[model samples]
Target: MRVVIAGGHGKIALLLARSLTSAGDEVAALIRNPEHAADVRAAGAEPILFDVENTATDRLLAVVTGSDAVVFAAGAGQGSGVARKYTVDSGGSVRLAEAAEQVGTQRFLQISTMGAGQPPARGSDKVWAAYIDAKTQAENDLRARNLNWTILRPGRLIDTAGTGLVTLAPPPVGRGDVPRADVAAVLTALLPAAHTFGMTVELVSGSTPISQAIAQLSD
Candidate 1:
C-alpha cells in the first residue's frame, strides 16, 4: 500500500511510519521541516516537505495523489500557544481530508484523542480542555468527509514498551492510557481491516492481549 502520513515527523507518526514501512508498505510522509527529511528517509519512507498550516490544498492533493491511504498524524507541539492547537490540530486535519478527497484517496486513518467528541468535565484544566476541543473539531471534520474514514481516539499516550495490549470502547471516564508502540501496532493492523472502515472507535490500553484487542476491533 502507498500510505501518506501527514505530520510524519511527529512522535507517534514516526513510529507508525516505521511500522508500516517495515511491513513492506510504501510510505510517504508529509513533513514541515526539511531538516527532518533525513530522519524520515532513515525510517525507510519518502518525505515531502510542506507546512500543514500554510500549504494549499492543490499542492497537498498532488502529494497524496495515487496513494492508497492517508493518515492525519500531525500535531502542534505542547509548547505552542492555544491558537496553534486549532490551526495544526483541527485546521490541518480538515485540509488533509479535503486534499485526500480531491485526490480520490478512499482510506483515511485519523489519529485523534480519547477526550475528543466529549465535553470536558466541569472545572477541568482550561488548557487541557482547549486541546481536546481542537482534536474534537478535527475528528468532526473528518467524519463529515466523503471517504472510508476510521477515527481512532486513544487515551493519554505513554511512551512505554510495546506490550501489544490494548482496550477499545466508547469514551471511558478513567481508563485512558496507551503506549506509543502499541498504538502504532494498532494502526498498522487496522490499515487493511474492513471491520474498522467508517468506524469511530475510542481506544486505550489495559491488560488485554494486543492480538486479542486487535482481533476484537477487526471483528
Candidate 2:
C-alpha cells in the first residue's frame, strides 16, 4: 500500500513510516521543512515538502494523488499559541480532509489529543482551550465528511519504547500516558481492518495485545 503522512517528521509519523516501509509498503512523508527530508528518507520513506498550514487544497490533492491512504499527524506543536492551534491543527485537518475527498483518497486517519472532545474546565489555560477547540472541530469535520475516517485520541504521549500493549476504548476514560511507538503500532494494526471505519478510538499504555485491544473496542 502507498500511504501519505501529513506530519512525516513527527515522532509517531516517522515510526509509522518506518513500520510501513519495513512491511514492504510505500510511504510518502509530507514534511514542511526541507531539512527534514533527509530524516524522513532515513526513516525509509520519501519526503514531500508541503506545508499544510499554508498550502492550498488543490496543491495538497496533487501531493496525495494516487496514494492509497492519508494520515493527519500534523500539529501546531507543543507550546504554540491559540491562533496557531486553529490554523495548524483544526484548519490543517479540515483542509486535508477536503483535499483527500476531492482527490478520491478513500481512507484518512487522524491523530488527536484525548481531552479534545471533552474540553478542560472553563477558564482553563486559553491556549489549551483553543487546542481542544481545534481538535474537537477537526474531529467533527471528519465525521461530517463522506470518507472512511478513523480518529485515534491518545493520552499524554511519551517517548518510551513500545510495549506492544495498550488500553483502547471509546471516550471519557481516565487520563494516562502511552509510548509513541505503541500508538503507531495501533494505527498500523487498524489500517487493514474494516471494523475501524468511522470509529473514534481512545488509547493509553496497558497490558492487552494491540490486536486484541482493537478487537475489544468493537465488543
Candidate 3:
C-alpha cells in the first residue's frame, strides 16, 4: 500500500514510515523543513516538502492524490503557542480531510490524544486546553466526513521502547503511558483493518499483543 503521512518528521511518523517500508509498502511523508528530508529518506519514505499549516488545499490535494491512505500526525510542537494549536492540529487536519475527500481517498487514520472531547480540568493552562480543544475539533471534523476514518487516541506518550502489547478499546480506556513505538505499531496494524472503519479507539500499554488487541476490537 502507498500511504501519505502529514508531519512526516515527527517521532511517531518516522517510526511508522520505517515500519511500513520494511514491510514493502511505499510511504510519502509531508514535511515542512527541507533539512528533515535526509532523515525522512533515511526512514525509507519519500519526503515531500509541504507545510500543512500554510499550504493551499489544492497543493495538499496534489500530494495526497493516488495514495492508498493518509495519516494526520502533524502538530504545532511543544514550544508553539495556543493559536498554533488550532492552525496546525485542527486546521491542518481539516485541510487534509478536504483533500482526501476530493481525491476520493477512502482511508484516513487520525492520530489523536486521550481526553480530546472532554472538558479541560481546572487549573489546566491555556495551551493545554487549546490542544485538547484542537484535537476535539479535528476528531469531530473527521467523524463528520464521508471517508473511511479511524481515530486512535493514545494516552500520555513516552519514548520508551515498544512492548508490542497494548490495551485498545473505545474510550474510557483510562489514563496511562504508551511508548511512541507501540503507538506506531498499532497504527500500522490498523491500516488494513476494514472493521476499524469509523471506530475511535484509545491505546495504552497492556497484556494483549498488538495483533490480538486489534483482533479483539473486531470481535
For all predicted structures, in order, the TM-scores are 0.93, 0.97, 0.99
Relative to the unseen true structure, what is the C-alpha lDDT of residue 53 in candidate 2, on a scale of 0 to 100? Answer: 90
Sort by TM-score, best first: what order? 3, 2, 1
lDDT of 1 at 149: 89
Model 3 C-alpha lDDT per residue in residues 78-186, reported as the tens digit of each score: 9999999999999999999989999999999999999998988988999999999999999999999999999999999999999999999999898999999999999
lDDT, candidate 2, 1-219, per-residue tens: 999899899999999999999999999999988999999999999999999898777788898899888899999998899999999899989998998898899899999999888767778899999999899999999999998999999999999999998889887767899999999999898787778899998999888999999888777
Q: Evaluate residue 105 in candidate 3 and report its C-alpha lDDT on the 0 to 100 scale.
A: 90
Could you tell which candidate, 1 or 3, scores higher by lDDT? 3
Model 3: lDDT of residue 152: 97
- Of candidate 1, the 10-residue stretch with the lowest lDDT total is 168-177
Question: How much is the lDDT of residue 206 in candidate 2?
Answer: 86
Candidate 1: tens digits of C-alpha lDDT, residues 66-101: 999999998887788788988999999998899889
List where candidate 3 sits over 4 angstroms from the true fold: none
Q: Clashing residue pairs, candidate 1?
A: 164-210
